[model samples]
Target: MDLSAVTAALELKSYNKVADILDNLMLQVAADGVAFHNDWPYAIHLLSHFYVHDINSARFLWKTIPSSIKESKPEITAVWKIGQQLWLRNYGGVHEAIRGYEWSQELQGFISAFSELYTKEVFQLLVSAYSTISIEDAALFLGMSKDDATSYVLQQCWTVDSSSGMLTVKKQPVVTEQKLDPRKLQQLTEYVFHLEH
Candidate 1:
């Protein structure tokens, strides 16, 4: 699978463009359309699942998953199980395995921010892509071009400090740097909150 596209989108966190690609891919396989599964909780669940160390955050995400969907999408259940297992991996301490070994509030905050900024449909498209994709294909996906769309995604995932690991985000648009305003920040905040609940 071509991951370049995925990676490129990741850098930018351009969900709409990413969603469009995922829509095309899902059509190929007949998987329950990614768009159908998109919602705030899924974003919260997935972002926290991938980036946060806390089990409860993931658990919260799982709980948010619709029972009907879980019943229908066994693959999703399977993937969630794998994610749970990884989250439970023994971070061996002197006494025993510590479940909280990977805990990071920073990670949690990041996810929370995403949840607020993006909607459920926005996230579903992403979740569908990640589960279905392989690194090779991800690169292939990135190789395709949508110039404006690609730029929008890449710019959001950028930062100078390596301390904050770069991941895709629902990027904010700015017509010009000088034009950025509080309203734009508020809009992004809204998108981030959409996933938090």
Candidate 2:
């Protein structure tokens, strides 16, 4: 497979195509082991997974990377730490970890793309933590203006009292029985097969 082509596609922000290529590359790597000469492929693959919010796949890739490569590249360790904090839902820790760290151009771009997702994740965490939180507090937590925080809450279908500056999450609609489509079921089966093999 052409790893450079994959890198070029990622540089162009062609995430879906990169994901498909990385999926096959990961399978090949699993069977044949890493080439050991360079670690760019692993870094690119991890960034792709992170871009798509595939935390589990990214974690798996992280664990399988050789410790030698990890030690040689301090950036890999830094990115892994960010991923670990994200998985643990410690958004504050993630912010702290990345605060003063110098990021590669590629890593900075990846973080820029991931910021919107991170904001939503932080919003969800705030909602789970409180029945009603002030917009000011939400803004502080998300590092956004109060107006932006209010807009975000309203966009998520939560109730917001502009006068009181409070946000309330509506009760989630309970799904009685989720009927999976055949295609979805097939996909799940294939995923399980991949996990087993």
Candidate 3:
């Protein structure tokens, strides 16, 4: 998949929105006639990501994920089978499958059991911190325009007041006189760049 547009969409902080975009991308891949098998691994990886990261309905994917490829599967079973075939074809199946390409056996076992539950709870902590600090707001401790600050906030870089120091989205106390150092600025730039195109 060309992630350029999806990378830009990651700027949206709403995990629900990300899931929608992910589902749409999956649909696009299914619609395309070519290379379904090649793309299936990425599709499985994305499902794992959604199940591991997003708080909302993260458990839903786990429920839907087939354990040992049972019978009475959804049509989407084809997706997983294609992914498994591709995996085996490239790396060989089961115990012989390349350990590097596969999830750590322990981690995969844990995920197969409870990754959905774990991520939903973990995201609670992530959003809790986000409630207090935005990546955008962190950048402007030295001071930047409201528009720029808001862009960073929306991009999940910082959560500062849309009004610069005067106000924040949640009316929290503004951070006091601290200038961002070159090191912090570079890190923030890289973080936002990763989320954006």
Candidate 4:
């Protein structure tokens, strides 16, 4: 397979085509029963997975990459580390990993795409972190305007107090069976066991 063509496809952001090409290449490699001899195709394929938000595929590729190549290419290693952090929903770790690195044009493009994903992820994190936060504070944390922050909270079905300028997330109450009839409990257990089988 032509690795350059794969790289060119990735540069063009043709993720679906890249995925197809990578799948074919992987099948060939598997048929030959040989380890990947080059890292560029693997790295580019991994990046394509990231572009398409296929974290499981990316993680699988990452683990397959040879450790020598990972050590030799710091940029690829950095991207993998950041990608892993993002996959794990560790947004702070993602930020820290790329904090001071000098990004190449290609790397910058990947970072831009990741940044878009980060915004959505961060919003969910913020929601989980605080039941209520001021629009101003939320905007500051997310690097958005107060209006945008307010809009975001409303979009998530959270209530915004116009008077207090705070967003309130109404947590759903957890339903637990405090008391269950023995017959009903046995019926539920049987149902679950049958379903499992």
Which structure among the candidates has the greatest lDDT?
2
Give the least accurate 10-residue stretch of model 3, judged by summed lDDT: 91-100
Best first by TM-score, ranked: 2, 4, 1, 3
lDDT of 2 at 54: 83
Pick the TM-score winner.
2
Q: What is the TM-score of each candidate against the true structure?
A: 0.26, 0.62, 0.25, 0.56
**RMSD, every candidate, angstroms:** 20.4, 11.9, 20.3, 9.0
Q: Which stretches of candidate 3 lie over 4 Å from their true place?
A: 11-14, 36-197
Per-model lDDT: 0.41, 0.73, 0.42, 0.71
What's the true lDDT of residue 27 in model 4?
A: 82
How would you encode candidate 1's per-residue C-alpha lDDT over 1-197 as one tens digit per residue? 33355446545654324434433443553464335443322432344343333456457657766788778744446435535544654112210211223324423444334333432333334434443333222222332223432343345342222243233343334466576799999999999999796
32-108 in candidate 2: lDDT tens per residue?
86664364566666766766778898898898888888989878787777778778867666666565468788667
lDDT tens digits, residues 1-197, model 3?
A: 66444445444323234456656666787688544433333334333444344423433543544554334433234334423433343212211222223454323542333333432343333445545654333333313344654564455433455444432334335579988799999999999999997
**What shift in Å separates residue 168 of candidate 3 from its native position after superposition?**
30
For candidate 1, the clash count comes to: 38
Candidate 4 — which residues are off by over 4 angstroms? 29-36, 124-131, 134-197
Off by over 4 Å in 2: 16-19, 29-37, 124-131, 135-197
Considering only N, C-alpha and C atoms within 3 Å, which residue pairs clash in candidate 3? 134-158, 134-159, 135-157, 135-158, 135-159, 136-157, 136-158, 161-168
